[model samples]
Target: MARFICGADRHQVTLLPNRLDDYVSEDNPVRVVDLFVDELDLTALGFASMMPAATGRPGYHPATLLKLYLYGYVNQVTSSRRLEREAGRNVELMWLTGRLAPDFKTIADFRRDNGPAIQAASRQFVVLCRQLGLLAGGVVALDGSRFKAVNTRDRNFTPAAVRRRIEQIEASIARYLAALDTADRQEDEVAHVRKVRIAERLDALRTRMRELQAMESLVEAAPDRQISLTDPDARAMATRGKGTGMVGYNVQAVVDTEHHLIVAHEVTNVGHDRTQLAHMSRQGQVATGHEALSVLADRGYFSGEEIL
Candidate 1:
């Protein structure tokens, strides 16, 4: 038996109550989130239910949910389910929300219903940074990256993809039909089974072909000649790697060069950065509260129309 340092007894009780604040420090980032949300005029910012309803059961205060969201975002816990779990276990979150744990649906509903208000809150942070001189520089850098959406490649369709799929299906059907023809010329039990299997495959292929034809019509009628079954706004965007692409959204961001702070950002379905330079540059200028600003971007954003 090895002797170890003695530990406190689990049954031991303390005469003094331990305050939740004792677990959090004055400089903790969660404190910043709490203070920021507390100071915001949520009603003016368009957050729903700033006050409890005049009648009926009251809901969780928007401030409480906002604090939880901010804390979760800062900690990279974006999933509502994960946030709910954290609220139950995280000490900082316990203090932030006064130990009131809302379910995942409530958390998700807040985000879904308050998208514009949430965007306003994000802009408010940039405004605060500008007020603090973090965005003093008039120079900014613009860049865009493809973020994979929840949509899978199979769920997305383009005119070219539809054509390729049709061609492949047609080739498969032809091969099965030729095999069936060969089976018809044979005189054996195995030949009959082979013929049946080949016929089944051909039938399945025909059904698939009909589905593809319907999808082709939809793709052709689409404004961008593409459709994503999962995320309608998602698009097929090319990656940096050659011959690689993903079904996703393009996120463009303009950052102040001085403090490396994001001044403006946009989520777009358009896959390329060529047309985003001017728009992002103007947004950066507005975010920094500057009359004029200089913008720098990679060659990918070099477009004659955008520059002129």
Candidate 2:
């Protein structure tokens, strides 16, 4: 009989001591995140509550939270709940935060309130890359992508979409009414019950139809003829596939071709990339600190005025 390598017994105890630092390597990227946050002056970066309130219970240090955030960003664990879970389990995060686990709300609030500081921190990294000669080529690539917004398709409607939805609801109401009429002609008890249920459904549909009409009127009156119930700044944008679209924001980024480091980025509600060429090219110039920089983008960014 073949036997596998012997495994340690579940109830066995050993004298060997284990440390968190031993689990992480000398060249781990988490160390970079740790050292970077340590070098930053959080108070000078406009990070509020850098120092604990003298009178109240001491709060977790801003550096600890910042380290957790940076580590999470590098590891693609951006969700607050996910970060909270990782604090208890992930060795890298545990070591980075010194086994300190702030709750998810605390983590989320830090990100929400420190938007400007976070942006500055990202720019600082770009500066570091420049100092390292990563941006020496001075040629960058610009592109745009659609990122899904919190708003769902059902919650976003254009004037034409609202009219179509109203039409669909009216058709549904007509079908339900026809079924009710058929049941009325049957005279059976089951048909009678079905007729009553259909009547209720018809009434609900009429109410919904009225609501849709009201929404349609509002959509028509709006300047853009569109409305997104969840995220006001989100817009409906077309995707690569035919008949495929989403309600989202357009994220544009310019990356240094040499090291592939992002030099500039912007989020806008505009769906098309035509008008973004000049704006993103100018931003790339600023980020690279170059008087002249060549920008390359896909055909989507073709615009004579923007190129000029």
Candidate 3:
């Protein structure tokens, strides 16, 4: 007792390993995790390559990556980098993936390579809801929301705004040219005349005009004139219930009348809901296999043609 040892020879550490299996059993927050895994056709879901027959080392299974993604989405952790961290630290994620932590690149690649599959998986959830009698084909609600874009304010331009800018620039160029001509006539020897500055401004304006023209050309070439730096597919649309509205895309979904389960969804650049009724109705019809369906939309979706 008098001679105290500084460190134990074995240096036994009592760190508790994450027991993911036990947590995934009955009464867990994600009880359906097992059911979902068991019912899913992982091979057909485009994750066949995730489980490779490698020699000694185990490869990252696609299920692991998918589960991570699903969990991340459920918790609003959509970033790949954040998901990577969760895999390493979060107990639930550790259990979900069986303690296998895939790198961010791997997680990102899974998402990129399986975008269609992921979308299909979401649809499968809707199909499941339908099967469970959660969705009894009935009246559906329609709504949309706008999300901010990554493009800078200066880079974005409406057709009318662009035309106005071009006109102003042209006017400025004309005035500059007139000033230059007057300066030449008045006397080339006018010592302090800022002809070069005016000419330079005119040249810059011309350059901007060319850039604007190029952007216009791009817009013409695009299927949709709208572009977003962050999500290239995202569009600028208006909000519903209209206080002021936002600059983002209209995300429409068909919710079942009985349990309000979403049967179908679409994203559109069109701001107004007036034009959405027919398109959403058609989509709902296709999703539900119904010839005629009742649609209950907010006043925003009300239109003469829609009623017709």
lDDT of candidates 1 onward, in order: 0.92, 0.90, 0.73
Off by over 4 Å in 3: 1-18, 22-25, 47-59, 137-139, 167-202, 217-234, 238-247, 257-260, 285-293
List of clashing residue pairs for candidate 3: 237-248
What would the per-residue lDDT of candidate 3 be over residues 6-122, giving only the tens digit for each residue? 765576877554565755556764546545755788878766575587587776777777788888877789889999998899877777777788888988899998888877787
180-211: candidate 2 lDDT, tens digit per residue: 87998997799988988998998899999888
Error of 2 at 298 (Å): 0.9
**lDDT, residue 9, model 1:** 83
Please give the RMSD to the true structure for each candidate, in Å: 2.7, 2.3, 7.3
Best-fitting candidate, scored by TM-score: 2
Per-residue lDDT value at 161 in model 2: 82
Question: Mind sharing the TM-score for model 3?
Answer: 0.70
TM-score of each: 0.89, 0.91, 0.70
Show how many residue pairs clash in every candidate, following the order shown. Answer: 0, 0, 1
Model 2: pairs clashing at backbone N, Cα or C within 3 Å: none
**TM-score of model number 1:** 0.89
- Flag the better candidate by TM-score, 2 or 3: 2
